[model samples]
Target: MKQLVIAEKPSVASDLARVLHAKEKKKHYYEGKSTIVTWGYGHLLTLKMPEDYKKEWKTWSMDTLPMLPKQFLIQPLPKTKGQLQAIRQLCQRKDIKEVVIATDAGREGELVARWILQYVRYKGPVKRLWISSQTDKAIKEGFAHLKPAKMYDDLFYSAQARSEADWLIGLNVSRALTIQYGDQLSAGRVQTPTLALVRKREKEIESFRPKEQFTVELSYQGHPLTSRKPLVFSKKETAEKVKAQLQKETAVVKEKKVKVKKQWAPLLYDLTELQQVANQRYGFSAKKTLNLVQSLYEHHKIVSYPRTDSKYLPTDLESSMKERLQAVAKEFSLSGTILQKGKVQQRKVFNDQKVSDHYGLIPTEVAPNISRLSQDEWKIYQLITKRFLNLFYPPYEAEEQTFVILLGDQNFQLKQEKVLEQGWKEKEEGVSSLHLSLNQELPIQIKVVSSMTKPKSRLTEGQLLAQMEKHHLGTPATRAEIIEKLVNIQYLERQGREFIVTPKGKQLLTLVNESLVRPELTEEWELHLQKIEKGKEKKEQFIQKMKKEATRLVTEIKQSEKEYKDFALTTKKCPECSGRLREKKTKQGVFYVCSNPECHYKRRKDLKVSNHRCPQCHKKMVIVEGEKGAYFKCQSCSLTEKIPDKKAKKQKMTKQEERRLMKKYSEKAPAENPFASALENFQVQD
Candidate 1:
């Protein structure tokens, strides 16, 4: 009898099959002497919609809302129905002795498998394969000691609770708002609070009143007297009085202090921290960073798990330090330097208790092949590799000199820092050649500068990630999706690197329930969800709380005294229905969508990406068909390239050209296309 192993993705199934010698590839599975391997397309089954349970809930109406089902049902997503049928057939095989859940080892990953099994009504014995890295050694070890699937029931419960709760609150409240307000408005337990955070900042910027201010400073020999803290004056008159008094004063050196300062490297990369850095440095969206790092972990097999909340490794993993370091050293020439140091472990880098779910992002034992990585993948891989290597490096040291001077009985400080030792990096320093002794006298030069007080800046994607992490609004895996969903629905948008609240977003805050828009609501739910995961609380209790909250929110929207306006409406009308077209900004550039609910009219605004890249930014440029000709416009840097010659004749894509482009952008070959192609082209020696 063969044991069935269900993997999360087809590529992962290929890896598992290779390790198990399951070489007889079938249409949807690979079979070996005693093992059969199958895969899922991420999630083939999702919770059933409200309309599926009750026909009355099909139409969006206030009275029919708060559609609470006694027991949630599961259904196959339309796109993956074929995969679902294949899985169902595999589960019914009489020759199958046991089933293995070889999904990604996380809560959501657990849900991905369990939902499919539940929908298929499988009653067979089941096991789980849990591993952090996708290396051959890790996979072999994980399979050698497969655990019973019953042990991870708590995690599955937690995932189910989160899904159901989101359905109740997000769906009910969204329908009520859209119906009562007569606009396509959306609000969720997590997304509403996220929007509130952005809109709150916008309000702060709008209400801010700049004020006039003055500050006093003293400089000598073209060197300004500076301090770590700036000196501020409440009013110009007070600053003018102090400046006039200090004009006749001379600076007398009171104290000279010099000491060495040391700074250790930052802790390792949790998913959120890595996403924030990638967003700040490369302008990568949270979703983009997650995808790149995930590719590194899964496809490349060079990095550990990407969906982690911990920044520390466990004490047990310390033994693998030399191998990991040497593996990375081959790529980064500095690895030998790090290994030469006899002992290279830091307490902050490894602690048994701090490691949870998975350890911080680090390179696996797999020797990397840089030639296979794309430009963006190489960038993210280099980032993780550098951070992992820095853990073993010594602390960076610098020499600090602080001089306090007395000018008219007021103390002004001048500080200088110079690099004393380079650990992982060299510090930038600028120290003057002139030396001063204690009690030395110098002429004081005072200058008054006028400036206005500025309000807090808008939140960038990185800053928004930090805020979400601080309040526990979402997990490392789901937070990126939440941010993307907000952007997808037109509630918030990106203006350069910063987030701007749209007109509809502003009205959403006023219309949503007071508690629904507060971060604390999601924070509390997350706390309970964690408890449920740890078996400290019951999942049923959390679902009940969500149902109650959903009912209350629906009621609030039903009786709301306020109104909502379609701020997205535009002057353009749809050609088919003559309905007003509203401008929509999606991840795929911009589009004009019909405002009329019954009219299914939408058109692209010609901001789509072109195959050609900008000469400067290397980003894809958009080719817009205009009256004169089709021109290439860079969305990022706004560089424009016009080709007037193309106006006379339009270009068409040939079959050969289309096939070439398809080959460039597609993933691995299809599963039905024969696994022989995969095995024939690539072979792993390790």
Candidate 2:
């Protein structure tokens, strides 16, 4: 009997097809003597929307909220219905007696395949192909020892529970708040708490009051010494007095301590850590880094799975270290050095217990062709490659020196660090050793430095990801997208590198229930989800808990006396209806919307009149800004031209010239206008 294999995406299906020798390509699948391989476009089936279950749920109303469906329904995504049908047909093929689930080896991946199977009513015996990397050897080994699909039932349950819980909580709470507030507000089990974190940080920054303080710094034999107490005096008079005392006295070394210290290399890159580093180093958004790393893993076939949370390799993978090192030796010089050193030992880097679903992101046996990669992909690949090579290197060893100096009644401390061995830090410069004579008195110069206690800095995307990981607010695969979603919904705005909570975001925090906005609640839910995955907690129990929680939250929002005021008032009036326009932010950037919700008139705020004239209309073109860049758009004849740079030089117009030009345009009526015929043609088409 022929076996059918299903993959997560087209790229993976192609890799599996080549390795399985499935050369006979069909419309939607590849066929061979013993196997037929097909693929899904991420997810072919998704959880049904609220309206799909009932007619009353179609409109956003408080009465219809707390949408606790007895049995959540799954429907084929409208966009991918054709592909879903193809997969369903492949599953029902008379020759295919068994199906192999070869989608991603993670919780979400399990959900993607299981949903498709359930939708198609596929009941054939099934096996699972679980492998981290897409390399030929890995795929072959994975298929050689496929496990029963039943083995991953708990994982699938956990995935379903998380999805349903999110839908119930997010949709119900979001609808309740929006209905009450009369604005488009959203809250999720994880996203609300994550938003709370940003708001909390912003509040801290806003309420912070800086304090003026002073510290006395002393220099003796080119070594800087800090006060023994490390005290910050609120009064400059007190600091001046201490400085005078330190200046008059002769400093003596009371004690000296020196010890060798060893610093180990950093652990390998999990998706979160890699995203954090990329954001900090390259100013890449978390989502941008994820896309780049995913490309390196799926397209280049160089990096292993990119959505992993573990920062360690499996113990079993150690046997193939030599092969992996040799594969990358040509691209990386350190790989050759590591290969020459023979088998290197680092237990921390390879632990089976630490690995879950997939090992840490490391280079596969496939050597990357750097020339074929985009600049971002190459940078991410280099990051993973360097981290892998660093594992085999020695720990950074150094000598740390601490000296205690006595000046009158006060004692001062001085520190110096000297490198004993560069080790893993060979590429970085080492600190120089300090020479200090013990039990000797020396003349020292004292200076009082004025300083102030600054408030905490705003959270960058990197810092936000780290906080989310620490709190278990979201999984590695979803954290970046969550942040991006918050930005898209206008709850958070980006200012340079930092995330600023908008006025609407602060209002959202105030309106939502305190318990729902706490990270601890989301963390607890995540813990329970993990339990469901491990079979320690039943999926029904989690779902019941979520239902009850959703009910309570909806009731709280419904009965709340809190008021929400629209803070997005703008001076511009809507063209469709003579109503005041309000500023609204969406994924496509900021735009102005009519205050009258029924009118539904919106225009981009980025549009500005440019000096460049439309070739067809011969009128000034308006500059339209977008995510990528800006372009010139003519409203008269609907002509568009790309602006070379967003900051195109503006045409200067003197007051007299502007008045004269305005007068010339004002004198011409609509019927007599030069572009009137072209405008009429556009209107007729519309």
Models 1 onward score TM values of 0.85, 0.88
Q: Give the clashing pairs for model 2.
A: none
Error of 2 at 272 (Å): 1.1
TM-score of decoy 1: 0.85
lDDT of 2 by residue, 59-91 (tens): 877878889898999998889998999988988
> Candidate 1: what lDDT?
0.88
| Tens digit of per-residue lDDT, candidate 1, span 1-686 | 99999999999999999999999989899999999999999999888999999999998998798999999999889999888899899899999999999998899999999998998999989999989999999999999999999999999999999999989998999899999988878999899999888988888999999997888876877667976567678788888887888787877999988999988877889999999999999999999999999999999999999999999998878878888877777678764556766245455888888887789999999988999999999999989988887778788888888889987777878777667777766455554645789999987778888888999999999999999999899899999999999988878889999999888888889998999888998899999999999999999999988989999999988889996777778889888789899887766767898988889887677666778889999999988756675789998898998754746666898999999999887956555656776766687889
Evaluate all candidate structures by whole-model CA lDDT and list the values in order: 0.88, 0.87
Q: Which ten residues in a row have the lowest lDDT in candidate 1?
A: 425-434
Give per-model CA RMSD: 11.4, 11.7
Clashes of each: 0, 0
